[model samples]
Target: MRLLNNLTVRVLIAITLGILTGYLFPETAAKLKPIGDLFINLIKMVIAPIIFLTIVLGISNMGDLKKVGRVGGKALLYFEIVTTGALAIGLLLANLIRPGDGVQTAAVKGGDISKYTEQGAGMDWTEFFLHIVPSNAIKAFAEGDILQVLVFSILFGVGLTRMGELGKPLILTFERLSKVFFNILSVVMILAPLGAFGGMAFTIGKYGLSTLLPLAKLMGTVYATMFLFVFVILNLILRYYKISLWAVLKFIKEELLIVLGTSSSESALPQIMEKLETLGCSRSVVGLVVPAGYSFNLDGTTIYLVMATVFLAQVFGVDLTLGQELTIIGILMVTSKGAAGVTGSGFIVLASTLTAIKVIPVEGLALLLGVDRFMSEARSITNIIGNTVATIFIANNEGEFDRAKYNRVLNQEAKNELADYKY
Candidate 1:
C-alpha cells in the first residue's frame, strides 16, 4: 500500500496501463489527450512567473555583476561544445549503422509536413537572436516566452541590485511570492500520474504500436545513440567535475519520470530547478542555466536532427561528402539552438536544416512522423539530464555548491529508501 502511494510508482503504473489501454481500447484512449494538455497548461501558467521571480531573486541576491556575465558566457560556450559533439556522434553513428539503408520508402505513409517545411523556410537565424529582446514585456509574459522573460529578469535583477538597501523590501516580497508559486506547484504535481496516463495513452492510441514496425531500426538506433550519449559522454563530463552521474540521476528520478511520461521537458522544469537547489547548486546558477539550456543546450535534439538528416539522405540514396557532412554540423549548430523543449520543435529545426542544405528531400520528414512521439521521451529525458548536470558542473566550478549539504541530502535519501524497503 505504501509503495503504491509513491508518485514514481504511480506514474510508472500509469504509463504501463496507458499503453495497455491504448492498445486494447484506442478510441477511448484518444480522448484522454485533453487531460494531458490541461496538466501541461497548468504547468505553463506558472512557468513565466516562477522564472521571473527566481531569476530576479538569484541575481539581486548575488551582488557581483561580473560573475553573472562569466556564468552566462561559460554556459553558452559549454552548450556549443557539447551539442556539437552530440551532433558529430549522431552523424558518425548514422553513417556506421545505416539505419535507413535498404528501407522500403514506397510502403511508408507520409503526412502533410508542409507546415513544418513552411516554418522551416521562414526560420531566420538572425531573427531568432533579435527576437530574444522583447518589444513588450507584457506580451512576452502573456505568451510565456522563456527567452524574453529571461532577458527582462536579468535586467530587472541588475536594476534592483543597484538599488542596494532599497531593494531589500522588494526582494522579500518576491521571495514570498516565489514560495506561494512553489506551494501551488506542489499541489499541481499531485496530478502527475493522470497527466502521465493521458499523455502515454494518447500517443499509443493515436499512433498504435504497429506504427513502429516499419521504422523499428531507426527508432532503435536513435534510442541506442541517446543512451550512449547520456551514460558515456555525459558521464565522462560529470566525472571530470568529480560529481557522480548516478547520484544526480537518482536525485532527480521523479522529474525524469515526469519528463518521460509527458514527453516534454518543460513539464518538469520548475521541479527540476527546485531539486537542483536542494542538491546544493546556487539559485543563480540553476535559474540562469536551466532556462537558457532549454533554448541553447539541447543535446538530444541536436543528435536527433543530425542523425535524422543523414538517415534521410541514405533513404533517398543521396551520398553526402566529407565537406557536406561538416557543413551539416555547422548548419545544425545554428539551427538546432532554435529548438525548444516542445514536441514538434525538433521537426521544425530539422526542416530548417534540410532547407538550408537542399541536398536532402524535405519530404523525408514525413517518414519520421509516426515514430517521433515515441522518440520524444528519449529526447526530453536526455535534455533534462544534460541541463541538470550542466548546473552542477557550473556551480561546483564557481564554488557555489555545498558538498556538505549534497552529502547530507543523499544520505537522508538513502535512509528513506532503506526504510521504504523494510516497510
Candidate 2:
C-alpha cells in the first residue's frame, strides 16, 4: 500500500488499468485521449519558456563564446557518429533477420499516408536550414518550433554575452524565470498518471491488439535491436567514461517510464534536463545538447528509419542492391534529422526517406500505421537515453561535469535504495 503511493508505482498501475480498459471498452478508452492531450498541452505550455530561459541563461552565464562554439561542434560531431552507428546496426540487423520476409503483401491496411508523403516530398534541406532562423522570435516560441527557438536563443545569448557586465542583471532575471517555469512543470507533472492512462487507453483502443499480429516480427526485431544498441553500443560508450549504463538507466527509470506511457519524449524533456543538471552535467551543456539532440541526435529514429525502410522493401519484394542499401543509409542520415521529437514526426521522416529512395512503395507505410504507436515507446526511451548519455559524454570531456557531485548523488541514491530495502 505504501509503495502504491509512489509516483512510479501509481503510473505503472494507471498504465495497466488503461491497457485493460482499452482492450475491454475501446469506445470509452478512445474518449480518454483528451485527458492525455490536456496533460501534454500543459507540459508544452511551459516548454517554450523553459527552453528560452534555460538557453539564454546557460549561454550568458558561461562567459566564453568560444567555449559555446566548441561545445556545439563537439555535440554535432558526436550526434552524427552515434546516430550513424545506430543506422548501420539497424540496417545490419534488418538484413540478417529478414523480419519482413514471407509476409503476405495483402495484409496492408491502407490509411491516408498522403499527408506524410506530401510532407516528405516537399522536404527541402535548404528550406529546413533556413527554417531554423525564425523571422520573429515571438512567433517561434508561439509555434513551439524548437530548432528555430534554439537558433534565436543562441544568437540572443551571444548578443547578451557581448554586453559583458551590462548583461549580468538580465541573466540573473532569466535564471529566476527558468526556476519559475520548472516549478510550473512540477505542478503540471501531478497529472502525469492521468496522462499516461489516457495515452495508453487511446492507443490500444484506437489500434487494438489485433494490429500486432501481422507485423509482430518487425516490431519484435525493432525492440530487440534497440535493446542491443542500448546495452551493447551505448554501454560500450558509457564504460569508456567509467559510468555504469545499468545504473544510469535505474537512475532515470521514472523518466523512461513516463516516456513509455506518453509515447512522446517531449513529455519528459524538462524533467530530464533538471535531472541531468542534478547529475552534475553543466547547465550550458544540457541546455544546448539536449534541445539540439531532439533534432539531430535521434538514434532511435535513425534505427527505425533504416529498419522500416528495409522492411518495406522486403515486404514489396523489392530487392535493394548493396549500392541501394548504401543510398538508403545516406538518405536516412539526412532525412532522419528532419524528424523532430514529436510523436508522429518519425512517420513523416520515414515517408520522406522512402520517397527519396524511390524504390520501395510509400504505401508500405500503411503496414506500420497500426503498430507505430506501440513502437514509439522503444523510440522515445532510446532517444532520451541517447541524449542523456551524449550530454554526460560532452560535459565530462569538456570538464563541465562535477565529479564530486556525481559521486555524491550516486552514493546517496544507493543509500536510499538500501534504506528502502531495509524498511
Candidate 3:
C-alpha cells in the first residue's frame, strides 16, 4: 500500500522485480509470458473504442469543424518536423558509431513484405482512404478497425456539434463510457509489473547476450544519441517554455517505469493523459495531441528506422548514396505515419522500408529483432516525453495552457486525486 501510494517508488519496484525475474529465473519467467501478452491484448481490445469515443468527445466539445482542422493541421505539422529530425539524427548516429563495423555474420532469412496487409495491418493508401466509411458500425467495432472507427467517430462528433443540444445525451453517454474505460485502464495498470516482468524475462531468455554482442555498439549509440537529444534539444525547447519535462516526468515516474519495464508506451497512455490534465493542460489539448501523436509523432522510433536501415546497409557493405538515403527518409516520413501503434511496429515499418529501398534485404530487420524489444522501451519513453513536451509547448504558444491551474495541480492533492480517479 505504501509503495503504491508512492507512484515512482512502486514503478521502480516493478522494474527491479522484472529485471530480477528475467535475470534470476529465465526459464520460469519465460513460461510466465502469457501474463504480459494477456495484458497487452486487454489494452488493445479497448483501444479502438477508446480512440473513437475520446476523439468524438474531444471533437464534439470543440464545436467547430474548422477549428478541429486547424488544430489537427498544426499538430500534424509539429509531428512531421520533430519526427523527421529524429530519423535524421538516428541516421547520423548510426553512421558515426558504425556499430556493426568490422563484423561478419551469416545472413538471416528476409521477410515477406506482402504479409503486412493480410493481418489487420492497414490497407494501402488508396484502399485505406476509400474504406473510411463503416459498412456496419457494429462489425467495424467488432473487427477493431481503428481508422474506420476514427472516421466514424469524427463524423459523428461533427454531426453532434452541428446538432448542438440534441446530441447532449449521446455525448454525455460517451463521456460516461470514456470514464468507465479509463477506470478499466487503471485496474489494468495494476498488472503492469507482471507484464513487465514476463515481457522482459521472455525477451532476455529467448535472445541471450550473445545475440546482441556484435550489435551492442549500435544499440549503445542509439540510446546515447537519444539521451543527448532529450537533454540538449528538449532543454532548449522547454527552458523558454512553461511546464518543465523534468517536473511532469517526475510526477508520472510510475508510468515511465511501466513503459521501461514493458517497452509499451501505449500501456502508459491513460495515465499520461491523466497526468497531463493534472499538469493543467486544457482537457481539449491533451485529448487532441496524445492520441493523434501515438499514431503520428513517434520521433524516437523514427530515428531507429533510419538508423537501422543505414546501419544494416553499411554492415552489408551496400552503398546507399546520399540521394538514395534522402529518398529513403522521405519515403519513411510518409509510411511511418501509416505504421501501427502495436508491438513490433518498428520492425514492420523497417521491413516495409527495406523492401522499398531495394538495398538491404528484408532479412536485415532480423538483425535487430531480438534486441528490438530492449530498444523499444527507450524509443517509447523518449517519444512520449517528447510528444507531451511538444504538446504543452504548442499549447503554451497558442495561449491554450492554464498556468495558474498548472501551479495549483502540482501542489493540490484534491486535483491530483481527481486526475487519478478516472471514473
lDDT of each: 0.90, 0.88, 0.73
Residue-pair clashes per prediction, in order, are 0, 0, 1
Best by lDDT: 1
If ranked by TM-score, best first, what sequence of candidates would result?
A: 1, 2, 3
TM-score of each: 0.98, 0.97, 0.87
Model 2 weakest lDDT span, ten residues long: 335-344
lDDT of 3 by residue, 267-287 (tens): 677678777767767666666
The 10-residue segment of model 3 with minimum total lDDT is 114-123
Judged by whole-model lDDT over C-alpha atoms, candidate 3 comes out at 0.73
lDDT of 1: 0.90
**Global fold similarity of model 2 (TM-score):** 0.97
Query: In model 1, which runs have C-alpha deviations exceeding 4 angstroms?
Result: 341-343
In Å, residue 154's CA in model 1 sits off its true spot by 0.6
For 1-423, candidate 1 gives per-residue lDDT tens digits of 888877888999988988999999999998989988888888998999999998999998778999889999999988988999999999999999999998788767778899999988888889888988999999999998888999999999999999999999999999999999999999999999999999999999999998898889999999999999999999998899788899989888988888887898889999998999999999999889888998998888888899899999999999999999999999999888888822369888898899999999998999999889999999999999999888888898888899999999999989878887999
